[model samples]
Target: MSERVMPGRADGLITLDAADALWVDLTADSAVPTASAAFTCSPAHARAGYVLLGSRVVATVKASGGQWSVLETEVRRAAAELNAVRMDRQDLVRIGPFRGAPKKERNETTLLRWRQRITRELQELGESERAVRREGGGPSHLAGIDWRRILVERTRDRTARTWWLPRAVVRLLDVAEHTETRWVQAARTCQENTAVPEPPSHPRQARDAGGRQTTSPKGPGASLRPYNGELEGQLYSVLSGKPGTSRRVAGWVCAVCRTAPATVLDHCHEHGYVRAPVCQSCNTLERPDHLYSNDIRVANHYARLFDTDTDDWLRHWHRCPGCRARTTLPLPHLAAWTAHIACRSLRPTHHAPRGRKPCGVLRVSWTGSQNAPRSCLLTVAVDFCPSGEHRVLARVPYREAVERFRIWLAETAPAVAAAAGPDRLDGLPAQFRPVIADTSGEGLALF
Candidate 1:
């Protein structure tokens, strides 16, 4: 693809390829991280003149411009600088927080503390939300946001539950964004902006749990600062530069082959996600590609011989070209082996019992790709009594399946755990097979 440059600024250009791009205007006032830095995105969107945040992470730093240690030091330096900014004597005009009448009736110090923490949190978030500004009619630092104007905007947003995260995460990101704004604002701190001297960063006196300084800002305000790489690159990637195109998953599954899962992933052992998974031949270099085909053929050959009973004998099949070349290849189960193998999962793939409740969920990950005929990029989760019938509760993204399973373990397993706890169903993973396929999208396949 070719670049089409417009006039003046470092942003605002079209792709000759007419690609969907993120337009960032770096010529305006904003900080841009170096190209070598690795980054991820945050789910922050604008609606009703507000930024909507997603349930999970906004972005993550895949890498940085320098060595890991160097990045750490820069963060330290930034923290120390921001911490030094004296908040003394600046009339702290806190807003957006109010105690309900019930709280007033109860009059609790515990509630008082919670309210204070929230106030500080809002203060920090306000600082961050106002960090980036448009550069119209030439340039101006942060679009000259007057604190007074910001308070007005914030007040408008405070009618109800209006931030973009769960209370805990909102509080956390608020601290991060605030710290960043404080630092960036400090970088551009100059004369002629009306003399109210912005709160400058201080040299950190001591490092904390995050390797940040003790002298750094505290509470929600501290977190709101730009401490992580994800927050740091926001304005640059979203505002001033053209980020790369949508990353579609690679096409690993081949349609013509008619494999169970068209895509076969070369998943690295010990890795959480399926960055890759090796094919049979790739799995064992000495094992020729033909071996796979042979295995499939043998399985299919036996499947055709099945009498379906006492000869209730179960048989599998595979018609892979790689193994077809070698008749003596290892006997194999065909494309449906996964589902066939996991046939036991179908036992209680229905509703749970009344009242008492069901056990935890099951998590399955199909390490495959779209192009691979045998690719089953999927996961299955079952909820039920750990030692009893398995109940099919929900099928969700693999990531979520993991979380739900974890939560189930925490909540329902106590009784079963308390009694013969050590005999818990923890080691059952080895026996459990992934549900391969279902004509109804509800049935988990057992090979």
Candidate 2:
């Protein structure tokens, strides 16, 4: 019976008779079929390499010369055309039989497997490309040999040529071009050395005290110290207690500075006991063990903690500008009064009112009990005004007063020394002379 020829669809789905016509059109230009002409035919016709008449698969008729070669050439041309079209439309290029999902969607295991497959494919392609290049051939020769190019050639529709192997691998894996190139080079190096490429190193997991690896709480480079559950629970108990200790502590000001709010829990490191709460700076600086070893006054201060009649160490005496009497000031008020003393001390000694003699001078005195006499009381007075009024600025504890003075001197000593010349250095206290000596040539001459 004569076979009935069905009409083809507009979407390139051709009937058995149309498939035969396509084969004839493909091979008419030459004795052998061309990949371009084969590609021009419907995908169904190219893929099948035969016409489907009802249930029977009927292969195309052979060309005139070299019948077996003609048949093989036709099948090959059809496959190349079919593969190029598939490569253009495929969402993920196939590596062997396995095609992976997008990188974001894949699990670790699947991603690792895909990476291995891609590396192997790259290594194989490199070997093939090198072999071709050594035989006076190039990428055109690799179109048939390099499966990666065959699987990932997007430019086939425009130029009818495959991309470079590394570029093709990049498109196939949906990776950066340089990343694929690195992989290719690594694979080639491994192949040359006859060794398998090492897998990429994952980020190191943080370990606890027990040496068990644990995921870091704050990602990579986070501290490895384990969270103390019991300590945290104890903290929560203290904070949520009936007396509201946290709120009470929040209300209290820094014990040391007495101005800033106390935010840190100060502790005696040697005795392993809690002490008064203080600000961050006071907490950091108040190392009793180190301070007591170096400073006699600090040792005395700590030793006096047990005494029933403890001296008022924080109390400071200053001549009040309004009262004109030595009035007691708190620690904060004393700090301000001492700052005022430093400001007056830094002023140029040569500067005075017109027609007034420059007899302005600063006077400092120290006082303490005979037993603990390390100059605990520091009294600073200045007589700089035209009236020659001897005004007592502050009578604060020596240590804190000296510390504040040192800070002020470091900033203003150069300007003061330069303006006042050699005579200024001669009048300064012996201890302060060294600081001025470093900043001025006239001060240096005193040595």
Candidate 3:
């Protein structure tokens, strides 16, 4: 902590025996704090300090549970304990490491200031002490103080200065002083053969000397300037995840879609070349669709077509909703036709075994001979059913064959339509028909 000094007395001091006895006897204020504590010049450990803040010492210990108050008892006991053994370092499991070696000062100005602090604390606490009480007409403990303040006050001269403990209390903290020592050796790896900055001989000179520091501006032994990520005259190749640039800035964008424009000096995580940087959108989310699916190809082709037409389409041939695709003419057909020949194509057949007369005129034909004109003739005698109505019909091919033939007809119909452009569709020049069916007697009805 910041040190304070009084002319005749010191502040807090502790004893190892007292600390040991603390847990067993909570009444004893010697418990080592499991938190943080700072020590300055105090009456309890006068020898441990130079002369209050002027030429005094500074020490600290960390507590186990952020118990800062424990630091007071711990440091006091440490100073007293170390002084007894003359040991430089120690290990106190609960308390942190500590150093007794005082930081030598250049002038007495610091010490003078410490003295002023002690004088102020005394002024404030002096009048309040008389009315202090432990439980009944006595004084209460501070963090860990007890009403038995005489021995403590007498040793540290609390009356004259604000004595918190005795100098001998340092021994109580010694057990952990060195063992908790923080030994840090900061090793830097400078592969680029860069210069390092040197430590300041006089702190103020380094700060206020018009930028003229005691340190060498260029030296192999000095510390490297923080770099501030500043790569002068060049980019400070920065590379984290995703696309990045060489140095911190000023690199060309990588033509390679996803690779970085540049690599970080010491680290590179990506698999591709870190050549140049890319724009923010490209790096973060925007990416090209690279797969070639049929939809994609179609879309691409459609896009190309759109460049000229602005719209491209396909024809959907209409079909009977009930029968799916059954139709004489598809909606997509440009032209279609049917050839109607007048004829009586069949006669009724009989159930021969049931005394039924039968003269079924089925259209029967045969090829006459090879190497000769075939007589593939078809005959249908005038026919009558039991109801006696004359009907004419021709047996076309099978269903599939009829469908295929229909498609063929639709295909060739356009050409036929073009030629028929020179003539009428019915060869008689037709008009819309009023369709009627023979449903009356004699199978003939007037419409």
Best by TM-score: 1
Candidates' lDDT values, in order? 0.24, 0.31, 0.23
Per-residue accuracy of model 1 over 1-447 as CA lDDT, tens digit each:
114333321121122111111112121121211111111111111111111111111111111232111122222233233233322222222223433311223332111122233344444455445353211221111111111212222335555532211222222233333333333343344323535432222333332224433232222122221111221112111221233211110112112111111112221111111222122112222111122221111122122222122011110001211111111111122222222223234423335575433234332334442223243233333434465544433333333333333343335333322232223333223331222221111111100
Backbone collision count in every prediction?
70, 0, 60
Error of 3 at 68 (Å): 10
Alpha carbon lDDT at 40, candidate 1: 12
- Model 2 scores a TM of 0.16
Write out the backbone clash pairs for model 2.
none
TM-scores vs. true structure, each candidate: 0.19, 0.16, 0.15
True-structure Cα RMSD, model 3: 41.5
Runs with alpha carbons beyond 4 Å of true place in candidate 1: 1-172, 179-188, 191-358, 377-379, 387-447
Ranking by TM-score: 1, 2, 3
* Count: clashes, candidate 2: 0
